[model samples]
Target: MAADRLALALAVTIRHDGNGGVADDLTAPEGLTDWVRELAEPLRDALDAEDFTADTAALDAVRELRAAVRALFARAVRPGPPSSADAHRLLPEDQAMARLNAAAARAPGAPRLEWPDGGAPVVRAARPPGFTDADRLVAALARDAIGFLAGPERERLRACPAPRCVRYFVKDHPRQEWCKPSCGNRARVARHHRRHRTES
Candidate 1:
C-alpha cells in the first residue's frame, strides 16, 4: 500500500491555499526536489539516492503526469464532481491512460522477489540499471497511480467539496465527507452561509 499512498500524495500536490485559492507544490525543480525529500520514506525505492535532485525537465514531466492522474481520478469519481480547481481542464480519459502507461514504461522494471529473515516473501518491481533520476521518479509515480486506480482503494476515492478546497482523498470511514477536519469545518460554514443568504 506504499505505492497507493505515494499515488495519493502525488495527486494531492494540487491543493487549496488557506487564502481561498489553488496552490501547487510542484511548480518548480526546487519544489519537486523538496517534495521528494519530504516523502523520502515512500520515495526511497523510486530514487537512486537520498539526495535526488530535480531539473526543469523533471518538473515539467511531473506536472504533465499530475494532470493525467487527476483526469483519471475524475473518471474514477463519476456521478460526482471532480476537484473544482481543474475540473474544467481535465485531460481526456484515453489520453491520460496512455500518458500514464507511457511514463510507467520509461523505467522498464521487472518483478523481483525478496524474503527477509522471519518475514513473509515480497515481490516488488525492480527498475533496471542506467535510467536517469527523472525517468525513475516519473515512472514510479505513474506506476503507483496505475496501481491505485486498479486497486480497491479506488472505490474510496472522493473529491472534497469544501469551499475553495481541491483535494482527492480516500474515505477512511463511512461518515467521512472531507479530506480533513478543517475542510469539513469549512464546508459546514459554507453551507450555513448559503442557508442564511437564501433566507435573507
Candidate 2:
C-alpha cells in the first residue's frame, strides 16, 4: 500500500483505543521505539542504523516534535492560510523554524542519472558521517512531513468527517468527502436519523 507520509509520522503519538476511541501511545519509551520502527522505509533505515535505543529523554523530545507536527497538519488542512504564529505557539519558535529549515534542506532529490537500468534509482539523502542514526531518522520524518504539506497533495488532505473520529486522510477523488467508506456511511446514517427526528 502507498504510505501516507505525514499521517504516519503523526500517527505514532495516538492510536485507536480498543473501545473505539483514540488514546496516547507515546507515553513511554518502548512505545516510541515501536512507533519509529513502523515509519516509512528511509526514515526507518535511519533509526535502525543508529541502533538507537529509546529512553525517557528521547521520548520527551520526540513527543514535543510530534506535537509541533500535529499542530502544523491541523492548520494545513484548514480553510485559510496556516498561521506561522500558531505553529510557534505549539513549539518553541526556534525549534519550529529549525525543523522546517532542516526539512527544506533535505527534501528528496531527483534519482541518480548514472544508474545502470536508467530507471528510478533508490534515492537516499546523504547524511554526514558525524550525524547519529537518531538524528537522521528525526530529520527524515520532519522532511517527509514538510514536503508532503507543501506539495499539491495538501489539497487532498482532509480531517475525517465522522463526528467522533479524529483521524485525517487524503481524499482519493474529487467527490470523496470522508477518510473511509465507514465514516461516510456513518455520516449519512446520522443525517438520516437527524432528519427523522426533526420530522417526527
Candidate 3:
C-alpha cells in the first residue's frame, strides 16, 4: 500500500460496529496480529519476520500510536468535524505530534538503494539493528502518518458524517461527500428521517 493509504488504513481501524456503536479492531493481540498480516505488503519493510505475533506491550504501544494518528487525522481535516467515536477525547495536537515523533524515533531507518538486472534502481527504507518488532511496527505506522499528513492527500481527508459512523476517508473525486457509498446512503436516509420528524 502507498503511504497515504497505509495511514488511512490505520485510522479506519476504529470504525462503526454496524450496530450503532464504535468498534476497535486493535483491541486484542489476535486482532493486531491479523491486522499486521493483512497489511503485510505495505508493512514488509517494518516487519523482521513473516510470522509476527503481538504481545500485550505491542498491542498497547500500537494503540497509543493509533490514537496519535487519529488525532492528527482529525487535525488534518481542519474546521471539519472529527469522527464521532472519539471526537471529544482526541489528544491535544502538540501531544499527539510528540507521541508520533517519539514512536518514529524508536526505530530509525535509513534509505538504501537497490538495483536488479535490467531493472531501474529503487530506494527502500533500511531498518537499523537492535529495534524490537513492536518498535518497528509503531515507527512504520508513525512515519506513514507523518508522510500522509505532510503530503498532498491531507487536503482530501474528511470525516464521514453518516449516523453511527466514525471513519475518516480521502475524497476520491470532486463530488464525493462521504467515506463510502453506504455512508452516503445512510446519511441521506438519516436526513429524510429528520425531515419527517420535524414535519410531524
Q: Give the candidate number with the greatest lDDT.
A: 3
Off by over 4 Å in 2: 4-8, 15-21, 49-52, 80-121
Error of 1 at 56 (Å): 0.5
Q: Cα lDDT of model 1 overall?
A: 0.88
lDDT of 1 by residue, 57-143 (tens): 999999999999999999998889999989999999999999999999888777789899999998766767899889988998898
The positional error of residue 147 in candidate 1, measured at the CA in angstroms, is 0.8
Q: Per-residue CA lDDT of candidate 2, range 47-117, in tens?
A: 46335667886676666666666666666677733323232345654566576556434333333333458
As for TM-score, the candidate ahead, 1 or 3, is 3
The runs of at least 3 residues in candidate 3 whose Cα sits more than 4 Å from the true structure, single-residue gaps closed, are 1-4
TM-score of 3: 0.94
Clashes of 1: 0
Report how far off residue 71 is in candidate 3 (Å): 1.2
Better lDDT candidate (1, 2): 1
What are the TM-scores, per candidate, against the unseen true structure? 0.91, 0.71, 0.94
> What's the lDDT for residue 7 in model 3?
81
